[model samples]
Target: MPNLKIEESNSLISKAVIMTGEAPSAEAVPVSTTRTGQMMWKDTFYAGEPDIEAVFDVDTEAIQLYQSQASIKYGSIAAGYSVLYAAFLAMGLYGIASVCLVIAFVFGVLTRLTCKRATAAFNTGGIHMAITSSCVRYDQEKPMVSTAIAVQDITTCTVEQRELKPYCGLFGTNKTINLIHLRVANGSSSKRYVGVKDPRNFARLVMTIKNRPRSAAPPVASSEIVFR
Candidate 1:
């Protein structure tokens, strides 16, 4: 005979247990290898059905590319300011030369800080993305950020790839970096999911959900339903 036990949280069912009357003989009990906090398929079902989910690690190449671009833009501005500073100094305009020099130093420092922060962010576990019939959700574990966007609000999904040249002595080869960019109906408002695996497939999944016909049945509240 076995007794059934139920676990509840806030008066809501969370888990159940079955206790046998007789203790299991030595070697009869099964060994379990599952770890706590590790994500399973069921964890992604928190929102519900017709959902496409993916977990990705940070894309180093993409981060590098972004940093490089930022550096180039800021570096160019700084270089221009530096030239102006020198010209002003030669023209005996001490006040303007000092101002230009200060501007150049600020831009140079900003470029370094931008790249450093970007690198730190990626070092944290990448991201988890889920796209459902009604919305798209994404969250990052470290730094703890989350966002949910209604599918209907999404206007565009695009995948872009760029070649990156890394310096490895004299024989280094170039690598390609892929990025998925999304746009909303609101002007100049957009979001990007970077360093994702199979970005094209993810984009297609979003498009399909966005274009999906509305269901006639009333929407079920996520909390009320239990997924087995």
Candidate 2:
């Protein structure tokens, strides 16, 4: 087997796996990274195998890499209100004590209301997979579709898993699947976490790489979309 070099970026945060098997006669095409953050929601893991696989072909099929939702945070609204309260308190020192208290109370109420609204508005959905760089080897007909995402777009590649014990402890009592968060940056240096089916093992494999940086990558076309 030829030592195939899978290079996405020269950064130290990208992931590449060079397995023994070659791509099934063709490289799969890339698909759109849906910005919509909605996913199939259920209380517990579905009573089935966790769907996880590499895209041999995407255009003709669907590959369920990992299903996780983005976190819907509402603390922003409450935090915003708290800022207003602080402002009111500053004014209180200027001989406007009663007015400051009233403003604080009003702002606190507004913040609470805003938080409630956030619970409905702020929600996390879907996994962030580097679809363009994730690929397999194949025939020349199936050229890999390159995404517009430049090397700067990715922060790191991560592998996730369903841990029996939560790292934070006492919060997630039940064992659940989680993505090994990869920090990928776009333009403003914001970090994003990506979830893989088996993160622990993936991380180990990544660390095994003698010299490499974590960064962006993804996959596929004409094929069977199977969810593990």
Candidate 3:
């Protein structure tokens, strides 16, 4: 019998494996970072999700500011009435003091309700935001408000640092807060995400993922012909 030799084509087999596995690599996988923040009623005030893919906690300062503002607004109104009631009581006007007390009680109840609403907005910490390829979603328990907005719908995303002066710069220290403003396309309305750490980086990451070009199908491998 004539001598014969058989050889395996390793190159061809390896190439086939590489091609099939290469498709996943062609698709750009999103990178995500977790952020923590306090939840405001406005933050989790919306509903519905656009298929969430990632989640980030609301910034702590944002939630704190929101609660503080709510407290101030309702507290001040309640306090004003309370002061009036105290004054009337001190003047020994029984009938007028009774009326003022009723008024103060009403205002105090309203303030308490407002604070409860704020608390119900989220749990102890803050709201958790879900980030998808196209939109971002804000959700929380208790109040059950979830909001989703597409990236393309976003017209403007800005980070602003504002100095907060207490007592009109009289005797208190000033603080700065970072706020992220996102405006909807072709609309005058905008949403603000505040106290986000490294707001610029977060904004850039969102925009980069949003603007990234959609990947096309992977190319099929072709064999080259060789002759000796």
Q: Which candidate's TM-score is highest?
A: 1
lDDT per residue for candidate 2 within 1-228, as digits (tens), equals 232223332233233343313232233232222232112212121123222222221111011111111111223444554565577567665445545556556655655543332242223321123222322111111122222233333334443334333322234454544434333344444332222333333333233232343346322111111111
* Candidate 1, residue 10: lDDT: 32
Name the Cα RMSD for model 2: 15.2
Alpha-carbon local distance difference test for all models: 0.55, 0.31, 0.52
Query: What C-alpha RMSD separates each model from the true structure?
Result: 15.3, 15.2, 20.0
Order of all candidates by lDDT, from best down to worst? 1, 3, 2
Ordering by TM-score:
1, 3, 2
Q: Which is the better candidate, 1 or 2, if ranked by lDDT?
A: 1
Q: In candidate 1, which residue pairs get closer than 3 Å at backbone N, Cα or C atoms, i.e. clash? A: none
Superior by lDDT: candidate 1 or candidate 3 = 1
Residue-wise C-alpha lDDT for candidate 1, range 1-228, written one tens digit per residue: 232222212321211111222344542322112222121221232333334333223465666555666677787889999999999999999999999999999999988865663554465444456665467777655555688888667666666665666542123576666666678668496686655544554554455444444569543222111111
- What lDDT score goes with residue 156 in model 2? 46
Q: What is the lDDT of residue 135 in candidate 3?
A: 79
Instruction: Give me the runs in candidate 1 sitting further than 4 Å from their true place.
Output: 1-52, 56-58, 82-113, 121-129, 138-148, 168-171, 215-228
Model 2 compared with the native: what TM-score? 0.29
- lDDT per residue, candidate 3, 1-228, as tens digits? 232222212122111111111122332232222332111122322235444433343555445555556566667877887788788889898788788778777777877755654575446544555556677665656566567788657745666766654442344566666666777777777787656544544454355445544469342222111111
Of 2 and 3, the candidate ahead on lDDT is 3
Candidate 3 residue spans exceeding 4 A from truth: 1-54, 74-122, 165-172, 215-228
Q: Give candidate 1's whole-model lDDT.
A: 0.55
